[model samples]
Target: MRLLVTGGCGFIGTNFIYLMQERHPDWKIVNLDKLTYAGNRKNLLAIENNADANYSFIHGDICDKTLVTNIIEEYQIEAVVNFAAESHVDRSINDPAPFLTTNIQGAQNLMECARQAGLEKFVHVSTDEVYGTLAKNEPAFTEDNPLIPNSPYSASKAGADLMARAYFETYNFPISITRCSNNYGPYQFPEKLIPLMYTKAVAGEQLPIYGDGSNIRDWIYVDDHCTGVELTLLKGQPGRAYNFGGAAEKTNLELVRELLSILGKDESSITFVKDRPGHDQRYAMDFTVAQNELGFSPSVTFAEGIRKTIQWYQDNELWLEEVKSGSYRDFMAEWYGER
Candidate 1:
């Protein structure tokens, strides 16, 4: 099974690539990553060093139509799984142009190329953020929920999701969309909540919390998300959308406290800060379709996943240092500078 996996260097994509390489020894995998601030080639050093490995990496953006088409044709890509995008909500709020370009335009380009190539399946990895916020008492988001994205990051994703749906409706394209919840696992860039808090708390630095720390999010381990995506590709119906979630819901404050507990740190490291505009109050997913059809369910509990994640960060301090230096410093300063 030859496949083109875009954004294979990012957090979730990195994990997905590792899972695929380890499980499908005979499958030829081609990874295309722009290697943006969040993407690190070092994440796949083990696989890259394996002489017998059937994985290749391409450093390029998904918006390049010529490059996308050439790689698909050259590799005889049987499937396309898109994981590339500017995903940080804060970054999107600061600048929305990159998000629109990469998330929407990139998706369109890849889908067009895939259609032309007649790929067997095209799985578009998405996020539950496209459903917007839910009230505290509201139920989790389902596959049939309306797209009411509240952030630039999510709006771009929603646009891409709609585009995928449109392709299926207009051209009978074999496309499946899977919207997953917040993912936390090894090699996750420190910009996100879990990694950011873990790094800060470990260094005795202040762990920033936004908007009274009441925002709730459903968390999923990266491996589980990858499995869900894989299952969706293998068994999911075309023109259908699925939701993958950990069923673990926690507020910002709660998650921070859990991290502090795991790290043996106290609340002294906590600091409340200003919330960004269009911040959603809550997000949860009801992945019944993925569960019933794809036989997908999260295996890692929140506590277990958090413990493993914290240890990964602790053991990979060198990686943290490298990624946190240079442009990452500038990004942090730009986002948290005023706070």
Candidate 2:
């Protein structure tokens, strides 16, 4: 397969590219990334350095319709896997303009280009947060759940998802959406929970927890999410949406405490802070449809996934340091300073 994977320098996209290369050696992949604060080119250094590798990287934004269309034409791209978006909930709260531009408009551009090109498949990677919060005793969110996105980030994603459905309905576009739960693994930007807490715990800095840390999220290893995406790309029906999850639900407090324990640090490092506005109380995914149709199931348990994640950060201290650029530090300080 010849694939154009947008946002390929970011967390999940990087992992997905590596997984595809390893599994499908003959496949050619073109990575289009904007290299935002969270998108780190260092994540794919190995792939970029290999002269014989069938991989290519284009530093660009998905909102650029001309660029997207040209890349599709130039590469003779057969399919597209869009991971591009403003994904962080806090960042989206801070500024929603980027999320709107990238998540909604950018996705529409890709779908339009793919439709015009007569592409075989397109997979838009989304998050479980679009289903909104669940009560403590409520069941997990299935694909049929209405999109009740609360955060600007999730709303933008939902907008893009609806657009995808529209294209399939109106233009007969071959687009499929996959919504996954929280992902933790290597190459993840440090702004996320696991990496943020891991970095702070290792440095002996205060680990900040939002609003008593009772909010819950389902956790999935990056590889498992990547596999689910690949399956959707290969087999999913048009206009259909699929959900994938790790089946591991942990509260914010429980996750932090577990991380501290893994690092041999004490709970004294944890500091409760004011929670962000419109904070969803819980998010869990019911991926039964994906399991039954795509033969998808999470392979990594949270225990094993967390340990592996921390080990990767430990081994790649240089990467951790390099990715913590000036902008990242400023954002972290400013965002947490108010909390």
Model 2 agreement with the true structure over 1-339: per-residue lDDT tens digits: 999999999999999999999999899999999998988887889999988779999999898989999999999999999998888999999999999999999999999988999997999999898898999999999999999999999999999999999999998899999999999999988999999999999898999998989999999999999999999998998889999999999999999999999988889989998888999999999999999999999999999999999999999999989889648889998898877
Q: What is the lDDT of residue 255 in candidate 2?
A: 98
lDDT score for residue 296 of model 2: 97
Q: Kindly provide the TM-score of model 2 when superposed on the true structure, using C-alpha atoms.
A: 0.99
Q: What's the C-alpha lDDT at position 117 in model 2? A: 90
TM-score of 1: 0.99
RMSD to truth, every model? 0.7, 0.8
- C-alpha lDDT values of all predictions: 0.93, 0.93
Q: Write the per-residue lDDT of candidate 1 for residues 1-339, one digit (tens) a residue.
A: 999999999998899998988889898989999999989998998999999999999999999999999999899999989999999999898899999999999999999999998887999999999999999999899988899999999999999999999999999999999999999999999999999998888888998999899999999989999999999888989999999999999999999998898788889989999987889999999988888898999999999999999889889999999999958889899789887
Clashes (candidate 1): 0
